[model samples]
Target: MSLQHFSHQHPLVFIASHGHEIEKVNCSACGELVSGSSFGCVECGFYLHKQCVEAPAEMNHPFHRNHNLNLFTRNPYLAGTIICDFSRKTCENFVYHYSCNLDFHIKCALFSHSIAEKKNVEFQDISRIDPSINTGNVTEELKKAECFACRKPLLDSIYFSPNCGFYLHAKCVDLPAEINHLFHQEHPLFLQFNSQRLSCKICQKPQGPEFVYCCSPCKFALHIQCATIPTKINQPFHRKHPLILQSVDECLPCQICQETTNLNDFVYFCSICKFVLHIRCVSSPLIIEDKLHHEHSFTLFPRQVLYCDACGTLGNYVPYICSTCGIFVHKNCISVPRVIKFYRHQHRIPHTYFLDQNESEPWECRFCLEEVNTEHGSYFCSKCNYIVHVKCATKNSRWYYEVDSTETEEATDSDEPVDLREIHPHNLILSGDIRDFKQCHGCLLPIDTSYCYCSQCDFFLHKACAALRAKKHIWFHYCQKLLKLTSGCIFQCCMCKYFTSGFAYTCDKCKERFCLRCSLLSDMPKCEGHEHRLRRFTGESKELCRGCGTSVHAFICKPCNFNLDWNCITLPLKTQHSFDVHLLNSLITLMITIIQEVIIVIFVKRKGIPNIGFIIV
Candidate 1:
């Protein structure tokens, strides 16, 4: 029958059936090899598949819901390159396009529509195909093969065809052709192969050459599992509000784990309560039964709390509580070690909830030289009366090590009398007597007790300072080279920035020096004035010290707006001033008070004191 189509100018003839002889001729509409039933114009050598010829001019495609896709005989883009969203193959002739720059081949659009409508008969139940029907070798070969769609091993149920060599996971075959995900709301994600091998935004894992839902323009991709996460979920801990999946750039803390979400791009957020949760923490257990941490199981306390009794840190929304002990704690703090040995102390310290206040003054933390709160948990040693804040003691793994409770406690190296003749040239005798005016040659700090005295040379070294190794690595130094212990030469300490002739750790390569006191400073220094740990200030701008009101390089607690200069940080707890008969308490406070009084006196004298001068009492 002679037929005339809008795509061609001349009349065409319909061929009911054609063999391989006519397969070489391409279809004018679909641009695929034309065979079987088709219409052809002999003079123009133009042909169209019967199905392609019958395709509608414009249709509502399931893949793109916002706009109707219109059939196009030529490339619609200025670049003249159109690739089908579904098949990911170049569409040379006929294509379906929407206003949003989405394109699809005629066959691909029809195939996806059939699949979405659940009318594709080619999708068969994988269980119906029995591997036993074939030989063991063929069954083994099939087992070793991976699904063509996801590129994952086909261990689970999959759609397979032996003749076509097509293998696809059942879930991959059912994936949506296009989806509007919360992670990339600017553009719709299309199911495509990971040809560029981009990393998944959700999991932060590199993607293999597998099927991934991707936004090509933004280069955003997500795995099938990550992309299919529910938009809203009702967690047991946060039963009042359903958390919605959102992409946020701001630094927010996760309610479940109480950790900053800066490293994560996507989080589950509750708009009503402003509660945020890490995607991985959505499945946190409601009850924890760790016997090593405690004898009783801890139940989830799903409410805002002021503080955690275990670590004494500010609490968040989701903390676990022990009903038996009446203690609320963070999930991560449940496994805090019972006993630990700090590098700064000689004796093993045990965790204690409360310290006895029988002493005249508040116990001080030896690590940071800050007053330790007797109420909160802390690491205490009964033998040495040494105490440290729980957060400070366990801040760095290199500074402390967990000790087995059952293991025998060995005498510390400081306790054993060491012959330092090799390094000091004098025989040093260990003494525990309080020397009134003796100073440690190693640290240059006054030796109160437990020091090695050399009466022959009038030199002394604190027991702890005497054990200083010849070479060591200071954690805070930018240059990681080992520092050598050197004496006799005066140099400015890189950490405290003070010039002293005392023993110092010198790095020849970096030309940096650190005094004995500053070399022992931990990475995170806890201050009594602030609840948070103090970090070394690295900004170029001047920061005023909270203690003395002077701008100097200092340790800063950013959250608390606290800055402490090196002089204030290393101030002795007790100092003997020539003006006072008794020992003065808190040298930092005393020095600042004296300085303020002197400033007031200088200002009065500068303004010219009146003739009626006060008489001395």
Candidate 2:
């Protein structure tokens, strides 16, 4: 006999026994196993149990009351796969779709049971743990262990599960449908699965399951893991007291790495000493095997150190020192890329742990235009004479590898001529004549060491200046922009009133010019010699250099009344003087001459010698 069924359009036939040959057949209506006598269509292979074929087409489910639920054997939305809202699992069988968006498993929609209504639900573990706890799961020992919600490992002792081996945290199972979070106080956060691939606000990283804490109205979503980070804790790095988690509303420098904390993330704050540390920095490993340098491992130190071998800055912060290589680097510096396409250079630049001191003159950085101490670590080009500071190369993200890096040759600081499209149409040849000083076009400072200059156009540039990128982001500038190098006009820098006939990064819209020296250093720098932080003083007032005693523009410590000039801070330890060509023996001869002059002048009434000037001593 043939009978019409709601699940299929074709007529169904009553099959008494299909035998054991058809070992498995499923009910199309409720998606259950079919056995014994069943109703089926031979042509379409649509089978259903006798009771399922008699079920209603539409029904009201207690869990969702806004709309009537419709049974669907196939996904109507054509989204390929759908998630069951009731069971919080991927649905492959029959589903009940409501309001054109909400989907539920057939079992959850018809035979619904809230977490509280389930008889197997346990409350023994939830009562002991703090209600507001953010992290860690209740302890459990099971052969096949899984959390009730996330289905991940539960390492702590604060979870509950219905099955003997399976478990989940009480917090995850008991999360309210909606909540008000301190980080996002403006809107109410709702618990839902993120099907839109929204990024998490706290970690700034995206890649996870569908379940998340979300604010549908604002489209703000955060991963469940980030939302559960403890608000306060005593960190192992700084263990004096509890470190409270604070939002980054303003620029606050991290005490461990000494870099400004990103405004989007949370930081551990110690209000008593104004100490702040980034979550990543606080969790840095004591010993790390850096990827770029495979020769030796680096160990972290807690005390403040002298100089950073990477950025070449004097700051108080913890450093990662490699005892085998005899080098000290900031924790953040360890993450600098081994090979980078710097905005300022045409070829790929690889980081060098040490530059050979065999060069006639010191190599200066192309971006900052500062002397690159060969004794420290820096990025160098093996193909050409190009070198840059680790921090300077990464300041802006403009210089990224657009093409395959393997196609380009390695960079080197060689004595080859370079062609600059911004400068004259001719290639500028490298000159290593220290005796002849030519004003550089970029910084407008006299180049006393190595330089690249065009004999045809009378254009000159410090080897460093010639390597400046077409576009860059300086420390003082708020945003990155294309820097145009221009000359043939007298320009005075707005920050530092220095007259420059050489080239500079010119802003035609703002009518501002910035020399290379002023662009390298930030307004606020922590100096090794000063007790308080030093601020760059640009006013045209006389300030004595604390080290050299020369009156000029200098960085000042307002509280201590101490000032240091750029020339004083960057002075080389040893220098060759014109008066003393004979090294150590010349100083002794000069002392003897001074003593004889003193004897002759004191013992005998004598006038000044012919070529000898008045002896101030």
Candidate 3:
């Protein structure tokens, strides 16, 4: 469409407005009324959005590949709905377009429609339009137009759908809150910010506001990211199993949906169903019971008992309670109605119902170097007592397969699906606390999650974050503890190998902020050969340190031109460095060799190297 047809579309006429009345469908940028003729504003003037001119009667986007895109005639920014994107198996929401079933952000659609057609591009439906509106009389109730989001009046920036008598404040037409993005099922994603993540409930694609739904309650939840799946399912992936809408009351921790499920936020998922969960919700069973392996019934437990003759994981999976002697054994141990086909050994081990611990020689674990007591266990053959840990026996978690029964969408009152995605690796706890520093005590990520801080020495991390991946990481020699960073102490960054002057992970003893990863230099591959393992700083305290005077999130060690972003503390240890010359992580032994040469040379020379000083051998 081009501006050539606008001469016949609308004629300038006087409009009455006691305050502000609906005027001609116009391009606020240009005096010409927008009636679907022309490119942007009259060639020399800014034009009204194309979507504004030809308001859709109905629309279905390609991205929203599966849903029925219904065109709504009313404002959608009125309320919200709990959304679940069946694709990612997680959701994030708290806002919606309005009461209308418009799925796309109003602003997003406005812009998309406006730019969809290039300037002067001839459209097949081109024709001179009769664009005229009668602002004959203003009703006392209808005259008061207001924005539903910010609750402001229709000011300068506004969008009106003339075909349906709908209106919205331009600014309020699009708005989304920050979320972890727990509303998808297939693809992995996080917050897109204002980049426009609004999509459809059925098609798993981007859409406009006309194809959405909104709730009447708080108006905080949104339906754009929802799956619109009906409460029942029978798909190719799960024909025999039944899938239903998650009930809010049944908030059991999902084994497959949560990465930890340690907190109480678990909701609607099926143990029997083969549906997978979000990365944040992936978890395996710690305890279970079955009647197949053991002659008697047995329950699985997560604690260690006497060594088992078969799998030796210190009674960690789950143990079965005996009706007699009060003895507990792993279901995979003792009794055998048992004929099992071994994958690794490739030999069928016939059922041997021997539960006697008094056997002459107890079996030893083949994988782990550990002794096994024959009491509550299984033994292979006399010659080869190849032992597998009970935990390792069922590594696939279970012996079952099903079709991926994706649900046919229905209007559901479900909350955002559980966040089965990856954890915020940076949200770990800071263990070694000190003053004026704000960094993770353990991983050295950042101090965002609820954390512990030291008034004397600022350190922090939420209790749960501190415990994350703690088993794999122990403290380094330089820093006594990997305390969370807090306010009150000065810090020097461990990364960028610079002395941070502001808030960071600092040592109380040395009064310096050296990050946990940098302090663990010896534990790393290339850092082993350095003259000294990067321990907590041993520098003496001095007042007026530049790094100590800044805010909590930044780690500034000015003397060395070093600054650490407090968020770096939780970074993985095997991460590759910037100055290492290689794009990949250095092998442990090779890394150690490089460190040795660099630090040794620096130690002997008594001065920094020409260009390699920061390359801390």
C-alpha positional error of residue 52 in candidate 3 after TM-score superposition, expressed in Å: 7.4
Give a tens-digit lDDT track for model 1, residues 1-617: 97777777888788887666766898888777787889898678888888877788897754344457898888888886887655556888888886666777887766556655667575553333434453453567577877656666665554455443355556766777888887688998987655556799886789764568887668888988788878788876678878888766678878767777774467898767778888888778889988865788988886767777777776556788999999887777787788987765666788878765489787766655556767667898888787877878788786788888779987443233233664488788899997355557676655677998887887788898788876766756645456777886545577666555678878889789998777767545777656887766644676899899999878877657788887677665544443554344345335644653565455446667543332100
Candidate 2 is scored at a TM of 0.46
| Candidate 3, residue 59: how far the Cα is off, in Å | 18
> Candidate 1 — which residues are off by over 4 angstroms?
1-174, 182-188, 199-208, 289-292, 302-304, 356-376, 384-386, 416-420, 423-617
Error of 1 at 174 (Å): 4.5
lDDT per residue (tens digit) for residues 532-591 in model 2: 767556454869999989998787776688888865554433443426766554564455
Best by TM-score: 1
Root-mean-square deviation of candidate 2: 19.2
Sort the predicted structures by lDDT, highest score first.
1, 2, 3
* lDDT score, candidate 1, position 327: 87
Error of 1 at 418 (Å): 5.1
